[model samples]
Target: MHGGEPSVHFINSVLVTVVVALFVLWRYRLAILGGMRRGDSAFLPLPAERAPGRAVLADGDIAAREQAMRQRVAAAWLLTTAICSLPMAVAYMVAGKMSASPTYALALTCSYMIAALPMIAVSLAWPPWRMVIAFVVMMLSFAALCLLAGIIERSLLGRPLSWKILGLVPLFFDIAWNQLWMAGLFWLLSWPTRLRGVVPITFAAVLVFAAAPFAGSRLTAVLAATEVGTPWVYTLGLNGVFMLIALPVGWLAWLRLGKLAADYEAKRFSDAQLLARTWWLMLVVTIGFDILAGRERPTFALLLVVGEIVLFPLVNHWVMRWLGVAKLAAAKPAPTLLLLRVFGYTARTERLFDRVASRWRLLGPVTTIAAPDVTARTIDPGDYLRWLTGRIDDLFVTSRASLDAKLARLDLAPDPDGRFRINEFCCRDSTWQATVIELMLRADVVIMDVRGISAARLGCEFELQQLAKRLPPQRLVLVVDETTEREHLKAVFGPTLEQVRVIEIHRRRDADRAFEALVDAAGGAGSPPDAWSAGKKDGANQAAP
Candidate 1:
C-alpha cells in the first residue's frame, strides 16, 4: 500500500497483540503461574539482626492521621479519575475534527464524567461481583444519558434525531471485545503453565495476534465490498512483523516482571513501589501505542479512549501514593488483627477483609495464613510471579526461629488505597500448624470464619482448637453461618463458646455488624476500650457498608 509506512491496520493489529500480552502478564499474573509446584530450595541465611523501628503516637494524633489518610485517598481517587479522562477528551476533539469552543468544552466535560463514573463506583465496592455490577450499571446509565443528551441537542438545533444513536448499543459490544480478548489472553497464559494442560489454547492468543491484520482486512472487504482483501503475502508479512515486534517486547517485559518479582520477594521493593514500577512499564507500552498512532490514523481515537480506561487504576494508585496516603497510614503502628477462614470462602473472606480494613483504621494491620487457593485474591502479583517461577522455596517458615525472624521482618505498611498489606504466612502443609500456633500467640485479636466448617475440614477444626486455647474470649471473634457444623463448635470451644463473641453472618447487614464486632474485639488488644472506641467512632460512623 505504501513505499515505507506501515498500513494503519497492520500498526493497530500489532498494538492490540502487544497490549493484550502485557495486560495478561500484569493483571492475571497469578492465573498464569497457578500450576507451578512449590520449590524445595534451602532457606537463605537470615540477614544481620537489627532492631525494628517503632513509632509512638498519641490517641488523638492517631485518630487525626487516620482521618487525614482517608481524606487524601478520596481526593486522590477523584483527581486521578479527572486526569485520566483528559486523554479521551483530547481524543474526542481530534477525532471529531472539532475546534476549541464552548461546544468542545461541553464535549470534554461530558467525556470526563462518562470516563470517571464507572471507576469511582467500582472503588467503593468490596466484593468482586459488586465491583463488576457497579461498573456495568454505570456504563448502562451513561449510555442512556448519552442518547438523551444527543436527542436534546439535536432538537435544540432544529435537526432530526437520527438512528445513529442506536449505534451506542453495538459500541458497547465493540469495547467489550477489547475486554474479552484481554480475558482470553489471560486464560491462555494460565493453560501453558500447567505441564499436562499445555495445548493449542496456549498458542491461540499469539496466533490471533499474528493473524489480526488478515482478520481486519477480511472485515474491511466484507464492509466495503468493492475493496480487495489483503494479499496472502501481505498477511504473512504482517504476521512476521507481529512476531518480530511482540517477541522482544514481551520478553523484555517478562524479564522486568521476573526481576521485580524477585526483588519483591527479597523485600528490596515495597508492594506500592512494585505496583508503581509495573504501572510505569505499562505507561511506557501505552506510549508506544500513541507513537504508532502517527498522523491521520482512524483508530487513534478509540485507542486513546481504551488506553485511558486501562490506565485508570494505575493512575489512581500513583495519585494516592503521591498524596502521601500510604505514608500517613504507615506512620503509626497498631495491634495486628489475625484473620483465618474456611478455604472455600476465598472470595467472601477477601471481601470481608476489604470491608474490615476499609471501614476502620483502628483495626491495625491484618495478617493471615496464605492458602494456595487465596493467593490470587490476596498476594501481590510480584510475589505470586516469584512463586510461579519456583524461586520461592523459602516461602513457608520451617522452624520456630525462622518463623520468628519472618514475623519480625513483616511489613505492616498499608498500600496507597489504605488497605494494609496483609502479612500472609506462606506455609507448607507440614509447617502450617506451627505457623498458626505462632501467629495465634502473636496476634492481638483473631477473627476466624468457620462458616462452612465440617468434619471434612480437619485443618479448620485444628485452627478452632488453637484459637480457643491460645486466645482469650474477648480477643477472638468466631464467624459462623448456617452451614457451620454446630457439633464441631460445641465439641471444640465447649464452655468457652458462651463467652466468645460468635457472630452469624447470613446477610450483608450481618457482615457489617460482624465487622463492627471484630473491630471492637480488636480494640481490646493493647488499648483501653474507651480510648479506642472514641478514636474510631467517627471512622465507623462514616464507613461505607
Candidate 2:
C-alpha cells in the first residue's frame, strides 16, 4: 500500500471512530453528568468537598451549573464535528483517496457535512416534521453531488456525455441507503428523547428497505466489473456476519445507555419502551411490504400474507400483554388514601404542586380539581343543567314547571363507597364551585396550595372557610411557600388560621419533606362525614362569591 492510501485509511478510520464516539457522548451527556453528580461508578467521581477552611458552594447549585456547562459544551462539540467534516474530506481526497477522478467519496462527504450542520444546530428542539424536511434536503443535496461527480468522471474518461446520466440511478440508491442507515442507527441509539415523532423513523425505514434490492444489485454489478478476487458469496457472507455481530452489541449498548438515562429521569424508560414498540411495528410492516410487493414468487408471497394475517394480531396481543405485565411488575402499590389537591390555577403553581405530590406518593393518589374561578361570568342555565345531570338527558323537561319537577326528582346521593369521586370540571364552567364544595365537604383530606395567594381567591377562599367551619382543622392541610407573607395567609383564612395545620415550603428542595409531613398529618385525621347531599342543597340556593 502506498503512503497516500495508508493516510487515507487512517484519516477515514479516525473520522468514523471520532464521529461515532462524539455522537454517543452528545446523545447521553446529560445522563453521564447526572451519573457523575450521583457518584455512580460508571462516571468519573466528583472531587471531595472542599476542606472546612475553604468556602463551599451548595452541591445542588454546583451540579446544576456543571450540567448547564456540559450541555453547552456538548452542543459546541457536535457543531465542531459538522464543521470539521468538510476539511477532513478534503484532506482525505488530497491523500489520493479520491484518485478515481471526480471523487464520489469526497462529494458524498461534503454533501453530508452540509446536511449535518443544520441538523446538529436544531437537533435539541426541532420537531419531527422539521427533521423530515432536513432529511429531504440532505437527500437532494447528495443526489446533486452524485450527478455532478458522475458528469465530471465521464468528462475525465473522455466518454461522450448524453442523457445517459440516468445511469447514476444505482449511485443514487447507494447514497440513499447509506443515509438511511446513518439515520436509523442514530434514531436507534437516541431512542425516545432525540426523536419525538414516529413518522420520520417509519418513512426512513420504508425508503431504505424499498431501495435495498436495487442497491444490492448495483453493488454486485460493481464488484463483478472490478473483478475483485472476493466471491459474491464471500461478500454477502461478510455483511451477514458483520450484522450478526453488530446488532447484539448495538442493542446491549442501547440498553445500557437507556438505563443510565432512566436512572437520571424517571420517564425515560417508559418512553423508550413505547418507541421500541413503534419500531417493532414498523419493522413488521416493512418486512410484510417487502415480501408482498418486491418478492418474485407470488404464491409464496400470498401464503406469507395469509400467515401474517393470522399471526400478526396474536403477536401484537402478546406484546401488549407483556408490556402490561412489565409495567405492573415495575409499579409500586397504589396508595389507599385519596388526597384532593386544591391550588391556584397557574402553570407554575400546578407544576410545583404536582412535583410535591409525586414525591409524596405515600400520601395517596393526588387528585387536582381546579377550583372554580368565581371571577368569571356565571355559566348558562342550560350548561349548568347539563352539568348537573352529568350531560345526560334522561329526564326530559320541556317547560320550567317540568324542569322544576325534574329538579325535585334529582337525587343528591353521596358516593356509596365514600370514595369522594370528584368529576374534573371544565375550566369554563362557573358552576364548579358547587362541585368543589360538595367534594371538599366529603373529602378525607384537603391539601390547600396557598403559595402565590396575595388576596383571597374568590371560590377557593370561600371553600376553605366552609371547610374550616364544617370539617375539623386537622383535615385542612395548608401548604404555603415561605415567601408568602403571614398577612396573605391571614387575609385568606381570617383569624381561623390558628386552628388549621400549616406546612411551609421554604424552598423547592424542602417541598418534598413539607408535603410528606402534610401527608402524615392528613392521614391521622378522621374522614369527613357524608356532607355532599346537605351541601348540595345549600350550595344550590347560595350564589358563588
Candidate 3:
C-alpha cells in the first residue's frame, strides 16, 4: 500500500558524517600524541631555515638566521600537519550521505584531503617534486606488487577465490593505501630521497594493521561494519596480543639506541652510519610493532621514550648541532655576559681550539673525529643532548678532606716552569674567552672544577674531547662533587666516556686519592700539560715580597 518515493533516496548521511568525524578525531589524537611540543606550528613550515653556522660577514649573524628557520618549522608544522585535513575530512564525511553516493561522497573528500597534507609534507622535507613523484611511482609499484603477489600465492596455495578475495586481496590493498598514508609527510619531514621507501612501507604496514577494523573481507567486513558488536570483537582480535609484542620491541629499540650512542662515543663508527642505523631501526620498529599495537597500551609511553632516543639525535642536528640552539639558550636572553672573550694577542689559536674541542667533544667521536665541518650557520647538539640525557652525575667526591687527600696522593711532579700547558688556544686580545682559555692552558696544576657541568651541556664534552686530544684524562683532575658515577656519565655522553678517568669524593678521605685517581684514569705516568706552574704565591704574599 505505502511506497517509497521513486525520485528521492535517503542514505544515513548523518552516520557517514559521524564516521568521518571519528576518523578526523583519531588522526588528531595521533598527531597530538606524536608531535605536540612547546613550539609546534601544527600544519605550517618554519618561517625560514635555521641560522647560518657562523657569520659569513659582520653583516650576517647566523644565529639570527637560525631563529627564523625555527619559526618556519613551527609554523609549517601547525599549518599542515594535523589541522587542515582533519576538519575537512569530518566535514566531507558528514556531508556525503545526505548529498549522494556514500562512496563517491567520501572519495571526493578523502582523495583531495588525504593528498593535501602529504603533498605539503613531501614538498617541504625533500623539495623539487622528487619525493612527490617518487611517492606516486612507489604507490603504483606497490599496487602492482600486491597484484603479482596475489597471483603467485593464489596459484601456489590453490586457495579458493573466497580466500583470495577476503584475505590476501584486502591485505595487499590495505598495505598499498597505508604506504600512501606514510608518503604524505615528506614536506613536513624534509627527508632525503634515499630514505623514503622503507619508512613509507613500514608506515603503511602499521596503518593497515591499525585499520584492521575496515579491512577484513566481504562477509566479515560487512558484518563488522554494520553489525554493531562486530567492532568490539575485531578490536579484541589482536590489540591485546600486539601489546605484548610492542613491549619487547620498544625495549629492544631502546637498547639499540644505547648501543649506538656508545659506538659513536667510542669512535667505533661514523656519524652517518651511526645515525643511519639508529633511524632505520626506529622506522622499522615504529611501523612493524609500535604504531599498530603500541597505541593500545601503556607501552606507548615507553615507545615515546624510545622515540626520544631517535628524536633527540635528529633534534640535535636540526636545532642543536647544526641549529646552535644551545648557543641561543646560553645566550643571555637580555645579553648580560655569557661569553667571556678577549681580543688581540690574548687569543691563543691552540687553546681556543682546545676549549672548543673540550666543550663539544662529549657529543661523540662522530663530531670530534668527523672530517672538519665548518659552516657559516649551524645548529649544535648542546640543547638536544641536554634534552635527551638530562644531567649525568659524572663527577663527585666523598668529602672535601678526601678530595684534598686524593690531591695530596697525586704524584705531584715538580713543575720546572711552575706551569702546565693544559690546552692550547688561538686567543686574541679582543676575545676575552680566548684570553681566559690561554690562561687556563698555561696554568700548572690545573684543577678542573667540573662542579655544575653536566654531560648534557656541550661545554663539558667539548672540554673533555680536547683534553683527550691533548694531555690525556689523568693530568686533568676531574673534581666531581662525589655524587656521580661512570655509567651515569656514559649514559649522558653515549660512548664518549670510554677515555675518561673518574674520581668521586664524597668524604675527605678521598682527598689523598684524587691525584692518583687522575693519573690512573689517564692510564699511566703520561707527560703532563706542556706548561709551567703559576709559581707566584698568593696575591698578598706576592705584594709583600
Candidate 4:
C-alpha cells in the first residue's frame, strides 16, 4: 500500500460513527440530569376550592398545579432523548453488520451503542439511587462489550487477545482527554458575563487545533500497534479531521442541553411538547449524519455538510416559534412627571415666564406657584392686599396660557380664600430651606430659571447648591439667557452647575427651542393631555412679541 495506507473508506466510516456516538452521549447525559431534578411523582390534583359561580385558586392549589407542570417537562426531556437516540443506535448496528472486516472501528461503534442503553433507561423517570445504579451498570456493560469485541477480532485474525486488549488502553485515554477539555469549556462558558458563552467556544476551537498533532500521535500509535491496518500518518490526519468536526457538534449539544435544563426549571412549556420537538430534531440530524458518513463520493458528503449548517438554524427558529418559547421581550417603562420650579422677581416677570413654561406640557405636567412673593416677610398689610390681587390676576393668566399649551385642565391647590397657594415661603424662616429641599427630592425633574438675572440671592444660591448635591445632574434643568457666561454660571452656582443641564433662552424666538432642549435633557414627559384648559383672565399682558 502507498505510504502504508490501510483504507480511507474505513477511516471515514469510523469518524462518522464516533461523531454520532458522542452526540448521543452528550444529549442523554443532560436528559438524565434534568429528569432527576424534577422529582419522582406526578403532581396530585387539587381539591375543589372555588365558590359556586366564581373561580378562585388557593395557595396550595397553585403549588399543586406548578408541580404537575414540572413533572410533565421532566418526562418530555427523558422521552425525547430516547426517541432521538433510537436512529443512531440502529445506524450503528447496521454499519457494524455491513463492514466486511469486522474491524475494531465497528466494534467501537457497537460498544458505544450498548453503553447508551442504560443511560436512556435512567433518563426515563428513574429515582436518584436507581439512576446511580443504572450508570454503574452502563460502565460495566461498556467494558464487557469492548473486551468481547477485541477478543473476537483477535481470534479471527489468529493473533493474541492481549495485543487487542493493549489497544483498548487508548480508548480510556481518549475518553479522559475529550472529557477534560469539554469540562473546561463548559466552566468558562458558564461564567457570569455577557460574552462568556462566545469566548469559551472560540477558545475551545483554538485549543483543539493547537493540540491536535500531539493528541493524534498518541491515538495513531495505539491503533497502529493494535493491527487496525491504518498507518500512523493517515490515522493522525483522520483524527485531526474528526476532532475538527466533533468540536462544533459537541458545543451545540452542550448548549441545547443547557437550554433544556433551563426550560424544564422554568416550566416554560409542558414536557410532552418539548420532548416531541427535541426528538424530531435529533432524528433529523442523526439521519443526515448517517447518510453523509456512508457516502463514497467526497463531493456529496461536503454538500450534505453545507446543507446541514444552512438548514439547522432555520429549523430551530421554526421549532422555537411553534413552541412559543422564544426570547422574552423587554418591558416598557412607566411615564414620569416633571416638576418645574421657576424663579424670578416680580409677579409680572413670573407670569411672562409661566406662559413660556406652560408650553412644556409636551414634556409632562408643569407645577409651580401662581404668584411668587420674593419679599413676603417684609410686606405691610396694605402691600399684602395689593400683592394678593396681583397674584389672583397672574393665576388667571397662567390658566389661559395652560390652555394654549394644550395642557389638561390646571388643578392648582387653593387656599381657604379660593386663591391658588404659593409654593414660596419667607426666606427668613430657618426651616424654609429644609421644606424646599424636601420638595426638590419629591420632584422627578427640577428647573431653576435665572433669565435676565445679573446676580443670584444667597437663598437661591443655597437651594441650587443643595439640589446639585442631592439630585442627579440629568434630572436638574437650569434655564438662563445667552448673556450668562458658562464660567460665571459655574462660579455663582459652584461645582454643581457644571453637572446641571443648562438651556439658554436669548430671545422670544428662542423660547420654543429652549423648551424643546429642556424636555430632551429631562428625558421627556409622561402622557400628554387630550386638550388645553379654557379659563379667561382680566388685565393679563400678552407674552413679549
Candidate 5:
C-alpha cells in the first residue's frame, strides 16, 4: 500500500470525532450508572416545612439577584477572552523582539473585550436562541472589531488608513475563511442542547476545514480586484486560519475543564485528584490542538503555547472560584419544581421554563414530562439524534420499574453556574399517569400551565385531579389564559379550585408575577401564609419549565 501521512483534514476530523464521541458516550454511561446506583426510594423524601422568612421575596430582590448573576456571566466571558488572548499577545511580543508595544497589546485585548460584550448581552438576553445569535451577532461584531483593529494598527505603523479598510474586513474574514468557520463553530459553541452532542460540532469543523479554503479563494479573488491591497489580503488570510482552528480548540478545552471542576465541586474528587485530572485533560486538549494545527515538532513557540494552555485553565478555575458559584448553590435548597403543561403547547411551555429556569437555583430543580415531539424549544439533541437513528424505545419509559429507576436517579441539583436542569420524565402511554401521581407527591411546588386546556385533553385533566388531591393549594400555582376552558378546569377541582393560586398571564409582566407566586409557594425567603392564594379567582399568570 502506497500511503503518506494522513491529510490534516482527515487527522483533525478523526481527532475531533473520537474526542467528542468518547466524551458523549462517557457522559451517557455516567448518567445511566447514576440512575442504577441510586438505592433510595423512587422519589426523594419531602422537605420539612419551615416558617416563612418574609412575605415572599420582593420582585426587586429576585431581580437584583438575577442581575448580579448576569454580571458574573459577563465578567467570566471577558476573562475567558483575556486568558486566551493574553498568551498569544505575549508570544507575539517575544517573537517580534519586543517590537509589539504594551499599548498595542492592551488595545488589542481591549478590542476583543469590547467586541465580546454585545455577544454576552445577547446570550444572556435569550439563552434558548444563543446559537443563532452567535452566528449573526458574534460574526458581525467580530468583523467590526477586526476592522477597528486594522485602523488602529495602520495608524500606529504610519501607514494609510481609509474607508478602504472596510473592504478588507470581508476580505479578511472571507480569505481567512473565518466567516465560514465562525458560522459553524459558533453554533457549536453556543449549542443550547444540554446533551452537548459532538456530532454537529465536529461535523461542522470538518466541513469548514474541507470547504472554506476553496470558497474563500474565489470570494477573496473578487474582493482583491476592488482596490484592496493584495498584501493585506494574503496577510490576513495567512494569520486568520491559525486562529480559526485554535479558538474552537481552546473553547472546547475550557468546556472539559468546566466538567472536571464541576465534579470537584460536587465532591467527586479531592484537591489532589482534581489537580491531577485537570492537568491530564488540559495536556490532552493542548497537545491535540497543537498536532491538528500542524505544530508537530518541538520548538520554543510550542513550549510557549503549552504554557499558555496551562495558564488558561488555572485562570478559568480562579474565576469560577471567585464567582462563588459553588458556595452560592450550597446555601440554597434545591427543591423539586414540578412542571406540568397541556400537551402540544411546546412553544409556550419552553418559554415558561426558560423564564423560571433563569433563576431556578433560587428555588430548586425542575422536573417535567418530555413532550411527544422534540423541537428547538427543549434542546435535547441526544434524544433527538437517538430518535433519528430509530432508537425510539430508549426515549421513553415502557415499564414501572424503568420509571422508578429514572425518578431515583433524577438530579435536583444545580449545575456549576448555579443553574438547575429540567429533568424530564420520558414515559410511554401506559406509564405517564403513574408518573404524574408520583411527581405530584415529590414536588415542593407544582406549576401546571393549563393554557388552552379543553375537555378533550384527558391527560391534562387527569393531572389536574392528581394535583388537587395530592398537593396543597398553597403549594400549587395554576396558569391559565384566554384559550383555557375554565369551566372544565373548575369541574375537575370543585371547591378546591377556590383555594388554589391562579395566574392569568397574557403578557411578560404577568409572567413576572407568576414567577413570584411560584417562589412563594416554594417557601423561599418570601412566602406569606396566603401570599399566592390572594384573589385566587382573578386573572393571574403561567410557564412550562
Candidate 6:
C-alpha cells in the first residue's frame, strides 16, 4: 500500500501469512492438542492409533470412554491451532513488504510480531470482572506502549506506527503476550488435542536461520578482537545480554506456578479452589520478577525477564516430565519437545491467571464438581470388572472408582497399606506396577478391570505363567475387553486349560454367576480343588499364546 504496488504487496503478504501461520501452528501445535488431555506427561498417554486398546468386559458393561476422551482432546488441539493463527494474518502482510533479501530476518520479524499479538489478546478470551484486571492491565500496557513507541520510533525512525505499543508489548503484563502465550500454549501442548500443523516446529527451524549470519562469531575477544570484525559479535552479544536476566526469571515463575497447581490438584484440591489461588500465585511471580529485578539492573534485568519469560517454561516442563518418569537424574533431551510441552503443560498445571483477573474470569470459567459428577453411575462394580477385562467397551467414559472397586473386591489383591497394592492405579501411570499382575499371584477368583488395560507387560497379561503359577490349580480368570478380546481369547486359551476360566462380565453387579461358580468349586472357600482344569491333560497347550 505504501509503494502502491498492490499486486506485489499482495503476493508478499500471502507468503508472509503462510509462513507466519505455519510457524504459529507448529510452535503451538502440541499445546493446542494437549489442552484436551491426550498426552498428560505426568500421567500417561492413551494410544492415539484410534484402534481400541485392551478391554476386559463381562456381558453388557460399556467401557470405551477412555478412547473417546482421548479423541476429544485431540480435536481440541486442532481448534487451538486455529485460534492462534487466525490473529497473525496482519503480521504476514507487514512482513511481506518489509524486505526479502534477509528472508530470515523478515520471517523472524513477522514471527515475533505474530507470536506477540495473541499473547496480549489472550487476556480477552476471558471476561473482564474476573479477568478484567488483567485485560485492563493489558489495555494499559497497550497505552503505555503507544506512548513509548511514539517517542522511540518517531524520534528515532522519523516515522510512527499505529498502535505500535500494542503491536510490540502486551499491555496486561501478567497475562500479556509472553505470559499468556507461553502459559496457554503449554497448557494445550501437554495433552492430546489433535493439532497437525508445522507452526511450533517452524519456530525452532527459524533458530537455525537466526544463527546462520552469526556463525563462528563467539570467539575469545582478547585473542582476536584487534584483527577482524568482532563488533558485530559484540552487538549480537550485547543484544543477547539484554535478554538474559529478567527473561529467565519470568519463565521460571510460570513453570513454578504450573507445577504447583498440578501438585495441588493431584492432592485433591477442588478445581475451583485451585483456579482461584493459582491466579494470585501467578500475579505474585509476575510482579515479583519485575520488582526484584526490573528496578535494579533494568537492562540486564529486562534481559533476564525476557529470557525467563521465553525459556523457563520450556526448561521447567522438561524437568517436570523427567521427574514424572521417575528419572533419578534429570536429563534435557529435546529442546523442541520441551518448548512445546511448556506451552501445553498449563491445562494440567493451574488456573490462577484466570481466577484473579476480574474481567477475564467469565471466559475462563472453572466449575467445582466432585468425583461423583465425573463418575459413570450407570455402570456397576461387576460391570467395571468386566470392562477392565476388555469385555465390554465404550470410548466415552472413565470410572476410576468402579475400576478401583473391582480390584479391591478380589481377595488376592495386595493389602491397601502394603507395598504391592496397586488399587486405583493404571498401566498408563506406570509400565510395570499395575494390580492385574499381583492378582494373578494368589486369588482363586479375580474380578479384574480390563477396560483400557492391555494383555502384554503393559496390560493384564504382563506376567503370564507367574499369574497361573501364583494361583496354580486354581483358575486364572481371564477378563477380556470386548473389542480386542475375541481375537485374544481364541489365542490365549484352549480347551485343556481347565484351570483358566474366562468369564465374560456384562454389566456392573452382574457378577453373581462368576462368584457362585468360584464358591461351589472351592466348597465355600473360593479355592480351586485338585484337578480343577483339564489338569496335566494339556500341559503342552498350557503354553498356548
Best by TM-score: 1
Q: Give per-residue CA lDDT, model 1, range 1-545, as digits (tens).
A: 22113334433444454455445444333432332223333433433323322223335244355457556755665577457655655655565566654333333443344333322322332444554675577557655655566567668878877798667555544543432333233223332211111111112233334444444444444544433434533554545544645666556556555665565555443443333332322332333334344434435634663575467657776787788766676666666777888775645775666565434433366678876444544455445455446655455666557678888877665545654556777764455677677677766677788777767766587788766766676777777765678777779766666666666665454566666566556544332343223323423444333
Superposition-based RMSD of candidate 3 using all C-alpha atoms, in angstroms: 24.6
TM-score of each: 0.60, 0.32, 0.23, 0.25, 0.57, 0.22
The predicted structure with the larger lDDT, 2 or 3, is 2
Residues 1-545, candidate 2, lDDT per residue (tens digit)?
A: 12232223323432343344334334333322232233211221222322211112223132233234224323432343334334433433443334644545545454434433333322222334556786677667667767778888888889888997866745775744643343344444434332222222223233333333333444555665565624753666646544544555545544444443333233222222333333333332333333334443345434443453344334433443433332331232222222333443434453443344433321223333433221011122222223323542222222334333533432222111111111222221223344345445434456666655555433356656665555656556666653445675576566656656666554444345445445444445332242223223433443332
Off by over 4 Å in 6: 1-241, 247-251, 254-465, 468-545
Angstrom error of the Cα, residue 512, model 1: value is 1.9
The predicted structure with the larger lDDT, 2 or 5, is 5
Q: Write the per-residue lDDT of candidate 3 for residues 1-545, one digit (tens) a residue.
A: 01121001111221232343334334332332232222321222112222212111222232343344334433333233223323333443342324433333233223322333332332222233444685576445444445555555666777655544335434544643552333333223423332222232223223333333222322353545677848754765555435534555555544544554454344343232232332333333333232334233334434443554454334323432343333433332111001111112122211322232221211111011100111100111221122235421111112334233422432212111111111111111122222233223322223343433543433455444433434333334554442334444445434434434334443333333443433232233443232111111111132210
Winner by lDDT between candidate 6 and candidate 4: 4
Candidates sorted on lDDT, descending: 5, 1, 2, 4, 3, 6
Per-candidate alpha-carbon RMSD to the true structure: 10.2, 23.9, 24.6, 29.3, 12.7, 21.7
Q: Find the 10 residues in a row with the least total lDDT in model 5.
A: 1-10
Which candidate has the highest lDDT of all? 5
Could you give candidate 4's per-residue lDDT for residues 334-407 as a string of tens digits?
11223333344455243323333433321222344222322221122222222223431221212223222322
lDDT of 6 by residue, 1-545 (tens): 11223223322333343455444434333332223233332422222222211212222111122123223322322233223222222232332343322222222222232222232223222322424464455356544544454456556656655654454333323323542443334323311111112222222222223332232323323324665545544665644533543355445544443454344324322222222122222222333233333233234333433443344334323332333321211111100000000112233111221211111121111111111111111122222323323443221112434334544443221111100111222222222222334333323233332323334423334344334334343333333223234434334433323445433333322233343333332222233332323222323232321
- Model 5 ranges with Cα > 4 A deviation: 1-74, 92-99, 114-314, 361-363, 372-395, 456-458, 508-510, 524-545
Report residue 199 deviation for candidate 1 (angstroms): 21
Runs in model 2 lying further than 4 Å from the true structure? 1-345, 358-364, 370-423, 427-430, 456-459, 494-499, 525-545
Deviation in angstroms for 328 in model 1?
Answer: 3.5
**lDDT computed for candidate 6:** 0.30
Candidate models: Cα lDDT each: 0.52, 0.40, 0.31, 0.38, 0.54, 0.30
